[model samples]
Target: MMHLIRLELKKGGFTSYLWGSLLAYAIIACFIMVLYFTGNNLGAEGFQNYEDALNAINTFVLATFIIYASVLLSKLIINEFKDKTIHLLFAYPINRKKLILAKLSIVFFWTFVNVVLANLLIDVLFITINQIFGYVSGTLTITLLVHHAIYVLLQAFGAAGMSLLSLVLGLRKKSAAFTVATSIFIVMIVCSSNGNFNLASIIAVPLSLAVLGILITYLSFRNIDRVDVD
Candidate 1:
């Protein structure tokens, strides 16, 4: 499995995507630090508000990670068909299940990396801003840090599921572009809705969609094994 992932990385060039996401996280971290420093006048939260700031931080991080995951996953898996490389892989002893697992593992690994990078970036930015602006008197506690960490993990899990689902859909449809466009459209509709959309509209909708994606992926892989490469 590890060897399979290594090959996928070499052929798919996913490291470049990982680097690109790191660059994006850096840019966003800097922007957020500047905004926080500029806006945090009048000594409002006073070291206690980091917890309060967490929810806002989560929104930004989730949005940024989703865009990266969706696009990268689509290109990685979908392009296998569009580029006609699925046939190349089948020429080896590997089966479709192993190949799909490799792709899924890559997605999961990147998701973990994103969570770490994002949280570290946010914490570093917070400290830098505090030091530069002379707001370092308040003590940083582990409890506050743990809260942020949990939220980041939750968001990453959501993204992992979504990315896998997106890749499966794109591969099955044989159109990375279409899957990406439809995903953006669906996200936009969800975003445009007011908060009145109900509880089910929020959690149930996305959770259901993600669940559907997993099912589709299973079905796609099951069918792929039955496909005639000739």
Candidate 2:
């Protein structure tokens, strides 16, 4: 399984995705800082303080990468189905279920790992910058940082899993555009916020959605060999 995953990653040429993720991080970092320094002109309803900024940043990253996962899924699966290249893959001397699982595992774990790592680096970077500038009127302590770390990890897991939910909509039409659009719609509902009331902050929403995603992933490959390439 690990070998197959490695082969897929090698052929997927995902180095560019990593570069794109970095660019996203830069944009998010700049966004929060602008909020801090801009003095309430740009609508900081949910981002009232420095601490709330963490949640806002995590939400942005989560939304960004869930959609990221969708685009990759489009390329790795939906596009192949559309172009009839999946028939070639099905011709290989491999278990169809394993091939599908390998592709999915890459997207899931990649989204998971990137979200966690990006939040960690950005959180620390934000703290360091906050120390230098003292923009928001709050003091950071070790206890709060520990708690935030746990929250971020849980959020990352949920985002990673819930990302697969896009497959439910994407595979139905074998349309890449539909896949990506569905992801955006999912992000809007889960991450939407008004005056600090975020759907994801409810805990049950993302947790339940994550569970649903796991079910969707299972259903996706449960009858793999029975699925027709034509």
- Tens digit of lDDT per residue, candidate 2, span 138-188? 777788788888888888888888988888788889899999999999999
The alpha-carbon lDDT assigned to residue 100 of candidate 1 equals 77
- The lDDT for every candidate, in the order shown, is 0.64, 0.84
lDDT of 2 at 21: 87
| Candidate 2 global TM-score | 0.94
Give the range of the ten consecutive residues with the poorest summed lDDT in model 2. Answer: 39-48
Displacement of residue 25 (Cα, Å) in model 1 is 1.2
Question: Which stretches of model 2 miss by more than 4 angstroms?
Answer: 40-47
lDDT at 57, model 2: 80
- Model 1, runs deviating above 4 Å: 41-48, 131-140, 186-212
On a 0 to 100 scale, what is the lDDT of residue 71 in model 1? 75
Residue 117, model 1: lDDT of: 71
